[model samples]
Target: MTLSDASSERTRVYVLQSRQPLTTDPAHAFPADRYDVVVVTDGTAQEVLREDVQAGPVTVVRAARDEWDSVVTSMPPDAVEIVTNDEYCVAACARLRDVVGLPRRHPTNVDGYLDKVVMKCHLAAAGVPVPQAVALDPVVVAARDTAERAVSTLGLPVVAKPRREANSRGVEMLEDAGAVQAWLARHDGEPGWELEAFVSGDLGHVNAIVRDGRVEPVQAGRYLGPLLGVGEGRALGGWTVPAGSEWAARAHALNRAVVDVLGTDGDFVVHTEFVARPDGRLVVLETAARAPGAGVSELALVHAGVQLEIANLRLQAGLPVPVPEPSGRQACWLWLPVPPGRRWDAARDGARAAELGVDVRVRQVGREGNDGASAAVGASVVLVNDAPGGLARTVDAVLNEPWFRAHAV
Candidate 1:
């Protein structure tokens, strides 16, 4: 147990958190006692990261594109940079390459998903099924015959998402041209849209870690309930993990081949969405080269038995570990249950905070729906255990509960 013994010693993994560790409880993997550096950039996730980095000295720095040069240069020359924020994604890499250069592992064509149109094209060309998609800027698409043709040809029930959006931001599901027009108006204020042929089926997902030359499944299952999107006055409702079999296996195999074809097996994590038809066909929605946001880190650890934080640590140390087997357990990352206009006072309401582990998030106040109360927020995570081929439980536990308050104060 001696700290001097390298075998038992915890590896230095910077659970680099810009917003949060994408987990309710990051302590599950890189516990403070084991992880060396837990760097929090800025925002609610940073606050949570700071709380979780208690095992060692936590460094809270306000890092920006301009500051990256001085920051990386200040750190130990060998210290590897683990990136998190999407806004500064490109800049983070550029700064790292210019400063502490070498051995930064990331997903191949990671930027493709940033553009919805590009993602569709790539998947379609690879023979990987995806929703019929087109790039539309409203007026831009209205002007171009080709773009206009896609708009006219694309069937109803289309979902328009900004190419650069995350967490369902600026995402709108439309049934006809009117909805499309309203959505296009919004897109004018944001990035161009990727209007996709929305697939109808049971919701499900697969997140895997690809290291060296292998793609290992971390969490795969159905989305028990509804997938929430952002609204004018409130933050979008997040997704809960479910136990779905039909698409899970097929998605893993499909993603495995897709990853192989893309040549991104070197060092990275992947999150792919899918639809399971009653006929047993699996359609891939889209994939991200980076780790899945929300509380996926814990799901990867508890269900897949893949220590993403540890793997990331090993990766940072230039040491790779073998992929482990998935335990087929259900796990999730849920937001605080607080409703819009409501606020979380963890100190004054200990029982409430403990009860609603995944309800509260900090962003509720920033948008149109917020009631305007400001204090940091937190989330929760659950890991299920299964015996043999059976699943632990339905994702309903994670989605439906008094622990998660659906109505905001």
Candidate 2:
């Protein structure tokens, strides 16, 4: 393209983010010349803005939470604009909804999707098969009744957690009523909790770029578990792509149904996890409206042949989508969330992780029991392909690792 051609293009997009998001496998720099203006919200990426890494004219505006409403509402109509899923972001999008014409999935859709309880309830009503779970409003849960509710509704084998937590924080899997009481005591004076049926099955995940109620799920990706023992809630194992099989197909169908059922009204990206019960059933376990955490942003791009950041932009702009057909490649990502409490031997485990054919990277590393998604110290991620076929073997390897075995509670 010549200089005139480059100048002739009349498209621009603004990414609302706190930082230049980290993805281990991306080659695209921030959109520069392609966009007319890039606004840095809250000045999180001010360095990027100051250095003018962006090819075009960039403006760095530092505004606080209170000032956002007045500013966003005052924006002049412009090119394609989108924002991440945050409370302030939602308000900003609402302020500029008509003028910017962002994908319908802006702040409002994001607001609804972040709350787990609402997402579950919405999916169930939308015709998806969800686990037996109860969502509570912010009413504080008494330690005593919390136990009774678990026993009465979810029964002996159950999982409990706060509705608003991420990384499975505060999640517990209890096999006996006594266990629920003990766990509830830990909460003491916290507000509300959700008790879910303790579901056991092979875990499968889905990442989709959806707009106008139509879903383009990248594919079902399966996760290997026992990765966790009793009461552990972190996802320490890696995942595989190209989930192909009768069971995987069913899981995929369930993903579509769940997304369509709890469907967001506008353009949005969703990540959901389905548990394939041993008894030939499926349960929708986890769902997120924003892009997935734990490094899946890169995994989705590499495995599914889609650029998630760009997809998020298109959906918000009401423009054409660019998700392509699969590249028939196998890829995997591990959530390197180490176990909490137990002092696991890391040296042997790191070697074992590589031996299991894992491309290992740590997402979190802190104090033992800090990343508390499980007993794990921090989050770890694994990337691989041939997801369904290779997943089981990799999981088996993870379970047998000395580091994993040492920390098993």
* lDDT leader: 2
Count clashing residue pairs in model 1: 16
Q: TM-score for every candidate vs. truth?
A: 0.72, 0.70
The residue-level lDDT of candidate 1 at 176 comes to 71
Error of 1 at 211 (Å): 1.5
* Model 2 CA lDDT for position 42: 70
* Candidate 2, 1-409: lDDT as tens digits: 1112134455444545443432321113223445444453774643333121224444545666565545554544453444554323544554556544433454345534556677777777766777787654454455677678768987668887677655556676788888777766766566657778877787777778777667776655666554344335455543535545565467667767766666546676777777778887887877766555544555666767775655554455555556646666665555544445543445666677667666444322322334344544343545554554564565556655655443542
lDDT of each: 0.53, 0.56
TM-score of 1: 0.72
**What's model 2's TM-score?**
0.70
List ranges where model 2 is wrong by over 4 Å: 1-14, 17-30, 36-63, 70-75, 85-103, 107-112, 182-192, 226-235, 241-244, 318-320, 337-382, 385-409
Whole-structure CA lDDT of model 2? 0.56
Model 1 Cα shift for residue 190 (angstroms): 5.1
